[model samples]
Target: MAAPKPGHRRVLAAPIGLALTVSLAFLPGTASAAPQNVALQTSDGPQLSYVVNTKADAATIERVKKAAATAGGTIVVAYEKIGVLVVHSANTNFPQQMRTIKGVQSAGATRTAPLQAAVTTEIGAPEYLAGSPAATATDVPGAEPLEADQWDLRAIGADRAAKINPGSSNVTVAVIDTGVDDTHPDLAPNFSKSQSANCVGGVADTSEGAWRPYDPASDYHGTHVAGSIAAARNGIGISGVAPGVKISAIKVSDPETSLFYPESVVCAFMFAADHGVEITNNSYYIDPWLYNCLDDPDQKAIVDAVNRASLYAQSKGTLHVASAGNANHNLAAASITDDTSPDDTAPVVRTINPRECWDIPAQLPGIVTVSATGVQNIKSYYSNYGRNVVDVAAPGGDKYQIPDTPSKNGRILSTMPNNGYAFLQGTSMAGPHAAGVAALLKSTHPAATPEMLQELLKEQADNPGCPTGLYDPDGNGVADSVCEGPKPVNGFYGFGIVNALDAVTAP
Candidate 1:
């Protein structure tokens, strides 16, 4: 496959296919409580995954589970704490029919792909890096061998922060993406095997080596993200933002498609919360729909279930940091066009109200939505922004924002699979930087709640305000994006660029 686009990272190309025709007439609060007999046999069509949501009560869950079985749905996993059940069923009308069951709050299919098998197609091998960049640094004494090329570290003051406090070993930030390569030298020192798990099918598989990438070459996204957050500060390779902290993997992306579905994401958050994880980095959005609308029952169910899981994690003291996408669209805008929805199958182009349609986990409340910045401290050309949507900014890299390093590459350099290092850019890269700083804060204040950690992140950030004049980084006459709000908090940079030094030293 070709290199991932600048804004979208690790997203596989959507093959053109037909969508399964399903009814959209299901409405919440309109279903009857009366019992009805529905046949319980799996259909001949491809098996699909669905999320049956109910009130967070044992009685309600039990009732739903019985109803689900009668509706031809086999329970994959049941999260009683959130009242969300992952179910596999071949019946095409499972979602529509489940919505009418008593005690069932909202239900819908999680992905456009069938549940029988994951979509795996190796179009081509990803371009891999075998060695460090051709850069020598004699000025920055005591720095790691490849740290000089990590302009992102210096940009966030993480280079200076590490001297004061390299975070704490007890603090763990979960990388909830594709699986990670824990054997890499740079990441092996700080890798926490006990906290890692494979959550590909909405279930936690903690077997030995289960958290590794399914394919080393194509499934290298999570390894890069882990290296950015907590790669050890050893002498051989690049140092992470919070080098002293431990990092774990929660593999959510599917094998070949690399798509993150709602069931997997919900499992990741729940697993992180139940486990001792203090923070989570979500760089990818939920698949199938780029923007889920609240008015639509199916989309609304996805939004509700994901938000419930995230809130549950936050309540349990886990801070969530997410990327603000790469579309470059203002999330605070009145309207926007989404042409890539139902991406696992065919898509329908349509205009949507931004207020009603949201990019899950990122646009969701309480998630620290981070925008991407370059070496110049300006918003990356492809970074999505909004007045209240973006909460902070970090180095996600810009091909146009040339760095002064020997390699002169504008992207971030981090660990890849098989003892390799590579340069890649996206808001996917930006979220981990913030997560690293949040981990540093967690190390400093071990007793702080998720709310406190989030406040500290914004309060300690260095506010650069918004850029003056039309925002155009390409030097072309055409304007790229518009900034909003005052200097301290704006659409582009949010509260400001995250300050790693402050994170380690803040009271």
Candidate 2:
């Protein structure tokens, strides 16, 4: 991700679709327990960041800013247009104190992590090391020599998709995750440096390479996802799903601390909307509160802040595409246990009413949600599914679940920092494919609104009927998960895996 010039990197350092009529969250795996490294999860004690929404009018905004100041918080950034103010406070009571202010519509700590938590590993990282090392250089006729190994691309027929339309540079898909390596040769050809910015600190920084991985060795998530969306049509590396579109990065997740808090996310959306981003691929979940409950004031405020930014982005013509998570649970269920909230702090397991609670941005309105499938076109073993949720599906690979050839590793391959490529599984990898397809659709139909795109996404999916009864892929005499809905649109493979070919050629 590109950071704003130094001045814009202000360190708050915090942190779809699927018009399936239902919703879900985006992320690779579940955080069922507290992190082992307490210090890295929390900063000095419990410094927290918050987004306070109020009336957009100057008087009300001033009142809100004034209230935050009085509440022992510093204004990191104040988005007057959305009437949202990002503030940081070490005071544990800052949220409650601000809520009592007259002009404040909602206020809450975005994360339980202490301010300035050190970034660490992303959600249960899977090893992508192949028999051979990824090379910095590449060959032509098909990008990288490993092109033959990218079964995920062929599985979804992206090569064929490109033949039909190849997409358009006018459309930009922002990878709002860790950070994208703009210099990666595979990505450079299509990277939109002007649109890339670092939003790691509750603000956008436009510095040179400001949006790059904090630690190239560890934070390759965004780059991988970005490559999947728009790597390049160049003869060097592998081509992306929509190699013609441009890519932008909004760095929100921190590699040192493995955190993606609220303030940073709110900022990312605003940046995407303010810029010319037409689509955004969100492959990570908003942490600190995995499932925010509307009844809980603190959680509600966090959700409200993000929803406001997302809605604003939508109004500006950005179609948000998110992963359906790798939790392997039924998102449409009435109740589920969330043992991880405030992931920065000790987590306590609590059951939640799915209908009453939500995984922000994913569950948020107007997003085009995407699920994952494997070689057999069956749901990825770990992907979350629900009849009311999951709008579409794409190739995300399944190492232990779905069997496949050419890529027996059973994971998706995309660009990595330092001009490399790696295999990665999980919905985290799945979302990019959907984002790429969305980009192609936007390019083909420039006049299509976010709503129109959402409809077309589902309309283009090649449906695969749900798995037999319990979906016991392991055959351990126990069911994996249940799929609810009928044909073309069901729980497992929502609308079926994404059809890039249809996306480009379909009328």
Candidate 3:
């Protein structure tokens, strides 16, 4: 989610759920270095966002209001049901001060980022056709012009799944991402107008086109994700995995393309829960720290706030699906390196244990963590792998590793911003495939629970043993990363590639 600028201010690469990946450093005067009883950090200016957790009651809410006043912090949006409050503060020590208030369960600066984050991400240089036009042809009922190019559809057996069940129009899958281009021809047919809203500044805005993507650099991500899940089978462009479902654009990313923050993320899930959303596709991680350690009080509050929001959504029957991430490190490993912290500012390098520090929402409880695979049914070079963490695999594309074909560009293609289509690759791209399958399952069995869908996903996966030896697809004559686990289930493939066909046909 980090913006692509260098020097003075570092990158704000919030690639948790996008195809964009860039390394950056943390800056000063950010939330991660929350100071005590002070408004300004010696290094940076006054600008901060914090999340406060308290008991769910009126008395605690009053105290929370008073505490915010004393600390020069203002409430952005407070989730009374879950006891989570999004606050804007100039006081660097606001979090430290808030902890002293009675009835406060936890308090922490949500992100190590400033109020107005600046970030830019590249989706990839897609292979645009010679005469691709922004205006798509009239709709009919068959394969779209680009349907043959969608290898991801066949890879997950979505074609077979469609034969079993084309899904129901009643089911809506929310794209909790940068934003979705609801106006795209392929998406407009199945777009749920009432379910779309912008949670950009930590508050839900339901104005017309409020959830539409505007930033040219990163907005394409959410749109691409929506198409992958439910682009209509109108015989024009491409077909989504579950073309019979509807898509909701829940915008959470900011204007500068900064990463999704805890406040926005919380609001997104809550909104989905309240509006009857059946499933959510999360391709990005909450910004700033890629791994929030539980030991740190500030980081703990962030994790707690988000966990509460997601849990509440699940309680309301919404399935939260998250991407495993593009980093190639083994999450199942005992330890890992995270050099990017407070990425909104300047970052500091650090090493940590996975059990204590988590790549949130993905590693968070109840989330269905998805891994990425290329056209060849092998793990994508950049996808993170874990025996205990990853739940399933799907086609996210691999430019260098997979075999080439005009249609198989080794990248997933879907609706771009202007009613057009383009390619992108990442674990960010894989989660939606699973979400689409889950939507089909939900459509086929509306009475099913999240637990039921999760079990069905793993059960239907086509299990294959781990590739023997060093699995390096780049052919650099060196091992890229080693595969772990066994057949039927493994660290890289997680139960094996997702089988959408079995999901709808299962008895």
Q: What's the distance in Å from true for residue 138, model 3?
A: 16
TM-score of each: 0.91, 0.87, 0.88
Top lDDT: which candidate number? 1
Candidate 1: clashing pairs of residues: none
**Alpha-carbon local distance difference test for all models:** 0.81, 0.74, 0.76
What's the true lDDT of residue 425 in model 2?
76
Choose 1 or 2, whichever is better by TM-score: 1
* Residue range 8-113, candidate 3, lDDT tens digits: 0001112431211110012111233223343422222476889888777888777787777778888888898888888888887787777766667678887665
TM-score of predicted model 3?
A: 0.88
Candidate 3 residue-wise lDDT at 295: 70
Error of 2 at 4 (Å): 30
Please give the clash total of every predicted structure, in order.
Answer: 0, 37, 19
TM-score, structure 1 vs. true: 0.91
Which structure among the candidates has the greatest TM-score? Answer: 1
Worst 10 residues of 1 by lDDT: 15-24
- List candidate 2 stretches off by more than 4 Å: 1-46, 117-144, 401-404
- As a whole number from 0 to 100, the lDDT of residue 228 in candidate 3 is 91
